[model samples]
Target: MEDSSEPFAILPADMFGQVTFIGGVSVEPLAAVGIIDEALTLVNDRLTEFAASPSFETDMQTVFGESVDVDLGRTIIDALSLGEGLPEITVVPAEKMNGIDGGFDSLTGGVYLADTSIAPNSVIGREPTQSPNLADVL
Candidate 1:
């Protein structure tokens, strides 16, 4: 965020003074200042290409409402300090998945079943050749 004092300098002196006047019913100037400060902070943080666009003023005015003064957008642009244009972004392709033997099996979606043998200590025992009688068990 830029210095708080910097916004004061960008804002119109007469408008600021009006807001400071005692017993003044209107707070538009104060609200405008707050809007400008917030907008400046947002632009500085995001660094989006929109800040450099010519329609930035119209966009800001629309966001802050028609009642807001034009100076707000001007101040925000100055605070952004946008250069000639936004930098170009380059995307690198992702590395392909390497399956077993440094190759992928198109069939079965590359899944393979592991071989297993029964041991004496194994919890899963072999199935009985004959079907057990439920009556006898009961």
Candidate 2:
């Protein structure tokens, strides 16, 4: 028997994957190693596309009228309100330097702002968002 695996022996770990035969010919899906990762990417893309599309409230109304009662529809609506699934207007606060200062502006980002009355806050990433139809509390 011929050593068909010799061709892939030099390939890197990421390039290695399961081999199959098609019509008596060898075929290799190099990316098969990360099928789960690829699936996650596809799922994320699908979710983003769905989010960008129009709302499904109209469809619900078309079927059950504009008023949804206490049921699966209502629950779905509530869950859908978990933010617009879009990016929020983030106001990234400045970080303070590590030092010992007893200045009066210590409260407001270590005197970074002229207005010391302001509050000091910082976050690693953008803040969470809410439904666009709802108030802009965030």
Candidate 3:
């Protein structure tokens, strides 16, 4: 992501193994997975080090603020950490689509939702539209 002017698709959950963590940059169906795959490649290499680091236990203690098992804490961090250079999804500052006029993709989901938030009215559909909808089908 790395913060771009380009529009990103707020894809369906099923697009990513039941949990869509990444969004497509330009509505290319594969963009989300592509990004995820790349990200996994990057982070996958670090998992061993992160897990083996002795100080990682200290890092865990710092995070938990209690005497929890260092192994468990390291495991959690190793599991959750997405690694460096994580792409920006531009989720923030968005006013989630919540109007009747705004359209939705029936094939993907029944209703349109911005979740906690979504792209603002102005930034949406400015140039290259990656909107996930089939107007004729709807």
Q: State each model's CA lDDT, in order.
A: 0.31, 0.28, 0.39
Better of 2 and 3 by lDDT: 3
Lowest lDDT 10-residue stretch of candidate 2: 110-119
Q: Write the per-residue lDDT of candidate 3 for residues 15-130, one digit (tens) a residue.
A: 22221322322233344344334433434456657677777767667877668797665666555454332222222212333433233454554332232222222222333454
Clashes of each: 0, 0, 4
Winner on lDDT between 1 and 2 is 1
TM-score of 2: 0.21
| Tens digit of per-residue lDDT, candidate 1, span 1-138 | 222212122232221111121121122334434433343334444444565677866887788887776675555544535422211111111121122111223552221111111112211223456322211111
Q: How high is the lDDT of residue 10 in model 1?
A: 24
- Candidate 1, which ten residues in sequence have the lowest lDDT sum? 111-120
Error of 2 at 20 (Å): 23
Order of candidate numbers by TM-score, starting with the best: 3, 1, 2
- Pitting candidate 1 against candidate 3, the one with the higher TM-score is 3
Residues 49-112, candidate 2, lDDT per residue (tens digit)?
A: 5434466556556777877552565454334344222121111111221332112332432111
